[model samples]
Target: MVKYLEAIRKELDYAYQVEMPQMDDWTEIDIQPVIRKLLVRIIGKMIVGNPACRSEEWLHLGEHFTEDFVAASIIMRLLPKWLHPMITNILPQRWRLRKGLQKTRDIVDPAVLRHEEANKKRARGEKVDEEDSMLNWVIDNAGKDQVLKILPEIVLVMFVPAAHTTAMAISNVLFDLCSHPEWAEKLRAEVTDVTNEFGLLGEKLPVRDWTGKLEFLDSFFQESQRMSQPISITPNRYAYEEVIFKDGLRIPKGALVGFVAVHNQIDPEIAPNPEVFDPTRCLRKRQSSPEERDKHLAGQPSKENFAFGYGSQACPGRNYAVAVLKMVLSRMLVDYEFKFKPGDSKPKKYHLMEFIIPDPTATLMMRKRK
Candidate 1:
């Protein structure tokens, strides 16, 4: 994951240095769409073995799949499983999903087949490419014959999570930065200082190198997620035994236990000024011991400051996410100047649907800095 994120950061850096110069001719254009395109492309290349997945087919596949999956998942949850197919089939969503799934299968099938064949050639004393990606790694690790059977499912599982989650997270962070212009200069200062000291941005900076170094940038991302969790609610967990809480509440065995992370994130007791956007909150807490900091941040599972999930189920992809976010934002800050549209006073409101809240559409007019 770290390596893949580094690859993304490198692409972003190239865009900042090489591509931005060409934008001088266009007087006005929406930068967010372009940035989103680049990010999705970089992430697609990382998740799937092919950079071409960012082409129209897979991009359309991503959009359709997200819509259909959300609709299907919600319907299945609200109604009985038996009734779900009937309702879904009646709607246009089912057709969109079928087509999207077919496209996804088409895109991934060839890659999986290629990896399998490569592994076979390697066994027969043929040299294989060293730069082969995650799909190749998974294929090599799993016995070739066994992998050939389960490869498609494995690819699907990896693709959906990475594509949806990474794209949404990037969108949220970009929107937040655009909305809160006050933090821009400070964030830029930090990124500039760090980049000057290290020569390059991205995975080259070790986890320890900037672990807590970019404090304000880290806090800003955390606060953005706190206000707008990627997923509204996490999965439902069935309790095998009774569990007691500090507030004299006992959850009985066989009961469903779930948490509303949003509530915990904004609770007055946890955060002194819950209503205001303050990016400094997490950084201040970081100065203290790990135990104390964890206590302060702990609550019902939420993206509210919990960019990653909680305890045993926390996201393993967090380290990679942080690295990529830092690298991308740092590069953007150093290379461009962003401002809102004229007379567009109010910030764009995040759009919420079921468990997901996507970034609103807004053009961040850009000019290359001297």
Candidate 2:
């Protein structure tokens, strides 16, 4: 999965070279759709492999799956589990999602069969080359019965975590950069200086080599994440057994609990002047002390920084997301200068349940750099 970083870098390069709007006197582009498509293509390639991932129909399905899945999930939670069938039967969005999953099955079924055939050949002492997609990884690692049953859902689920959040994060961070030109200049300089140091400008490098060198860029992303969290709660769980905390607070069996994510992240002790958006806030702490360095990284999750949840179930995809986000930002910094459209301001945020969503309709004025 980590090896896909170079692949993601390639996709980011493609977005810069092809997808981003050509600069001609403050040309405006709605980055939401463009960035979303780029991320979908990248993750689609990572999960489903080539040909299918690049297909226009498949990418379009990937985009709608997120929205439809969320709608169906809400319906499922509201109605009794026994009524799920009837509810899905009635809800148009749920029906669409089911159809999407079916289409996904149609797409991956051949790949799954190929893997099974390979497995049979290997069992007969015949050699077959290893495949790269996550679908193949599941076929090799997960039980055969589970793979057969859950393959379509697995493909759909991969789309859920990677698509919208990544695109929105990219969009919001770009908005933030445009709103704060000083920080944007600093990040551009850092991106330029480091990529030059690594000789990676306009080139794809391995995930490990170049990402670590962009310290300021990392901090800028971390700050953006801190200021604008996607989800409002963290580590939601039901107690299987009665448990007691040190403070004498006890959670009864089957009781639901979740951490107040925003409060923890905004606590003055953990993050000073939390209200102000300082792009270098985390970077300063990272450079301040040895212990704090790892604490502020985008993937590092603690009680205070629970954007990726906590404990064993912490997001496995975050490391990948970190690499991809950095790649996109680095590319944008080098390729374009962006700002709010003429006489337009930053878009206002709105909430859905506990989640905070960025304005997808907003447009940014972009000027290609010489």
Candidate 3:
């Protein structure tokens, strides 16, 4: 996926122009929907490549699948545990999911088949153009024979979560920036310095890692995440049977457990002025222990932060998520300016299930940077 960042970058530019509102003057937008469209297109291009990436039907599935899924999960959870199996079959969520899965197969299955056919041609010693995107990447790694059986499922898995979570992350960060515009200039300056040094602002677009050098931006993003983690508890585990701990702690069978993640973020022992939004926090940590630089990166989970989960089950997509986050944010900071729509400067976050999501209907005023 990292190898394809350049392609992702190009897709983002395309999506930005096509989907984002353009005006010399400030324009208020319900930015979340626009961002969803932009991310879906970019994710589509990365996952399956062109035409499918731009397909309205494919884009609609990418955008809506998770909404239905999350809503369904909430509804099911509200009902009795015994009713879940029955509800799962009859609920509108199940229908939407099945419908989306079919659309996913309809779009991705043929692409996978065509890729396999192209591979057969190459095996016959016939020249064929290389296919780019995660779909091809997965086939190469998973092998053609094994992947064909579940290619659409693989694409669906990648597309839904990637689009929803990343879009939410972007939205939360923008809302943070809007709430605290004092940090905006500092972030913009860092983006400009890094991009200019690497010639990222020009058409040539150097093939090197510029996002790595934006230390302040990285810290700022980490800080934004720290301030507004998606969930209140994490590393959720189920006790299949009764077990006693060495500390005399005991858990009954069928018990679920998780850490209170919000505590760590706000505990003054771990952070000075814990209530403050300090963009320099992670950067200073990274600097203090240069050997452990990656441990403090925006996407990496630590003893202090658990937004990405922990252990082997930690989000395998964290690296890709972090990469896209920085790249897109850098471009946004450099090319445009944004803030809350007047009188909504401090829109409060609302809860959905255990997740703390930004106000879904929030608006932001954005204009091209001069």
Candidate 4:
């Protein structure tokens, strides 16, 4: 996970320093697509193997797969699985949906096949790279059932959790900065201090090292996520046994239960003045000690905040996602000055479709800070 974060940070640094420096010449072009492609490449390299997965074809396939998955999940939720075939087949978007599925299969199948071949070679006493990927790791350790079932699921897991979520979160942060110009100067100062402290400007800094020192940036990200939770209510979970709630609410065995994270995050009792964007809330808590700070932010299963879900089923990828976002944002801040277009004073609001939160539609004007 750390290595993956480092890889993403390295790519982000490269983009900011090398690629973005030249973007001024292409003022007519939109940079969000470029940012999305870079993010997908860095993330893909970590989830799948590097050389095999980093292609224009794979990136396009992944994008299509993401769109199709969102559409399918939405449609399936509204209708029964038994009726989906007929419903999807008749829809105007059905062909694109089918094509998207096929494209995903085509992209993932090769990774699966490669893993199989690698396993065969390993079984025949061949060596495999220790730093390969989750696909290779699963193939080497688990049985054939796991390889067939769990391995394929990993791709889907990463697609929804990492790709879509991270992209949207980064977009939100950018949009927030654009909307709130007052916060931008403070964030830039924080970034400047951290960069100078670590000597990161005009140099490739190790992500792990820099990420640990980004207290304010970390706070900003946590605050942003709290305000704009990617998932509204976590998925419906079946109660293992009968459970009782406050106010005489009882849940029976096999009952489907839902938890609303958005309400908790905005609960004024817990977070006073909850409607305002305050990035310092978490940072103030962190001023004491590392252990206490962690405990404070560990997120209890109360009616407070449960954006990443609650209990044992909470998001396993939260740590990784936070780290990646921090790295990307830090790199961007250190390398570029970003702001909203002129006269667009209001921050754009994000569109929410069921549980998934779409990225805010806003244009940011960025230039390298001299």
Best by lDDT: 3
Residue range 94-188, candidate 1, lDDT tens digits: 67766765676677777777766776888999988734466677766776678666655665566665545655555566666666778888988
The lDDT for every candidate, in the order shown, is 0.62, 0.79, 0.81, 0.65
lDDT of 2: 0.79
On TM-score, the leading prediction is 3
Worst 10 residues of 4 by lDDT: 21-30
Model 3 lDDT tens row, 1-370:
6666678888888888898787789999888898888888888888998768888888888888888878888899899999988889889888998898788878887777777888899999999885488998898898878877787788888876677778778888888898889999999888777666667732444333566677787788888888888777887889999999999999999999888887788988877799998888988887787696766887778778888888887777777777787777878887789987768865567777677877888889999989
- Order the candidate numbers by lDDT, best to worst: 3, 2, 4, 1
Please give each candidate's TM-score: 0.80, 0.90, 0.92, 0.81
lDDT of 4 by residue, 1-370 (tens): 6656655555555544543444442132244565666566667767776654566666776556666667666776778789987887776456765665555566667777777777787899999753466666665567656556545456656755667677777766776676666777777787778777777732556666666567776777767777777777774499999998888899999997777667777888767888898877777766777675754342233346676677787777766766677767776776666675667543544444545453335456777656
Error of 2 at 20 (Å): 2.9
Per-model root-mean-square deviation over C-alphas: 4.2, 2.7, 2.4, 3.9
lDDT of 4 at 125: 95
**Which is the winner by lDDT between candidate 2 and candidate 4?**
2
Q: For each of the candidates, give the backbone clash count.
A: 2, 0, 0, 0
Candidate 1 residue 261 Cα shift, in angstroms, is 0.2
Query: In candidate 3, how many Å is residue 317 off?
Result: 1.2
Better of 1 and 3 by TM-score: 3
